[model samples]
Target: MRRSGPAVEQLIGALIPRPLPRPIPTPAPLPNLPPPRAPTGPNRIELDVARLVRAGRCSARTLLHQLDWRPEHRLVVDVADGTILIQRHPGGRVLTDPRGALTLPAAPRQLCGICGGDRIVLAADLTRDRMTVYPMTVVVRLLAEHHARLADGRRGR
Candidate 1:
């Protein structure tokens, strides 16, 4: 007829709403980035290309179409470690099977590399582009958070 221990706490819990956890915050830039370089030739093109990839507002096909370029135009995405090269040649897309054999998919995206909206472009693309993944700032923030978690984990009542 009466509950006054764990059961009582659980009963009260069922009636209360819990707050959702906060998302990770964006980290500030590292102390130094070279003064804005003059945007010209490959430099200008690369800058615009990176901005487009980062914005991710338009489809890759549409993005490529809007640019005044042909199959000859090659674009590279830079990251912390390496680059990703993008070629526009046709019959260039190859699908793979579970057994690691060359295969074909019913429908393959022409620009699957930049398909992800927020996450960094795939690592394979990074190497092909001959660019490096700029992750030191993100790494520092993550490590700081990780160490804070370690301290919290060791705390005792």
Candidate 2:
């Protein structure tokens, strides 16, 4: 071996080859996709959310108008929950006023739809749509009374 100084060592170091760089990782190849299905029959899916929303709004407005509820009265609309809650009483006469249009803080829960004390729940699923409604309990009670009267009359005969 010939004598090598720091300069010769540096030259050898420069001549020496450096190790190759690390290989880049590649993602796995995806599988072949399936062919799209062809429709063989009539397929229709029409969802008129705007129409449904409009219908609900109109129905609520009309009901409030018919019940003579004031515009200033509180009508809370919770779209996320799909519920409408009326906290205040209407000054106008209600057709199905179970405990009158006014609702006291300590009063029992009113079930009449016209009263607006209960929540009006709305639902729309993929295949069905539904809404909650309450009729006057007095009507059922009156019908029962009428049936009882008829039954009594028939028994006497």
Candidate 3:
């Protein structure tokens, strides 16, 4: 028996291994970012804390543990119009969070006022003794500009 036509051709093609499609690259930064304030640095990594919440995985605790910081370390959270920055307090003090994440006065809003309904970016700076969090308007803006940058390039593409 001979197999032919488009349907049969498609069936045969399905059994062959094919190269995966390339990932869609991240979009460029906004025109309004400060020229000198690009997000770059070796200690940084981006994470979607809001999604972690919905996934039932406590990222706050996991992040703290990854940075080797204990509950006694101070937390510095700077909430601004377009960003929410969380870091170890410069002076360092005793603070604790029952849920094992940055203890905020309230859950930080993912929506950004400047971006108009867009989710804010959540990036972390992991260091020998502390972790810094920068929930910005765009992950690329902060991570790209910061010196010594490291991104999770493997998305299983």
Top of the candidates by TM-score: 3
Q: Tens digit of lDDT per residue, candidate 2, span 57-121?
A: 21343333334444545432221122222333344221222222222111122223233332332
List ranges where model 3 is wrong by over 4 Å.
Answer: 1-41, 44-46, 51-59, 90-94, 106-121, 128-157
All candidates' lDDT scores? 0.35, 0.35, 0.50
* lDDT rank order: 3, 2, 1
Give the Cα RMSD of candidate 1.
17.5
- Per-residue C-alpha lDDT of model 1 across residues 38-140, encoded as one tens digit per residue: 6444332322222222323222332243333233343332222222333333344531222321111212212323332323321122222322222233445
TM-score of 3: 0.38
lDDT of 2: 0.35
TM-score of each: 0.23, 0.23, 0.38
For candidate 3, write residues 53-127 as lDDT tens digits.
Answer: 332223466666666557677766555554555666756433645556454433443333222223333455654
Regarding lDDT, does 2 or 3 come out ahead? 3
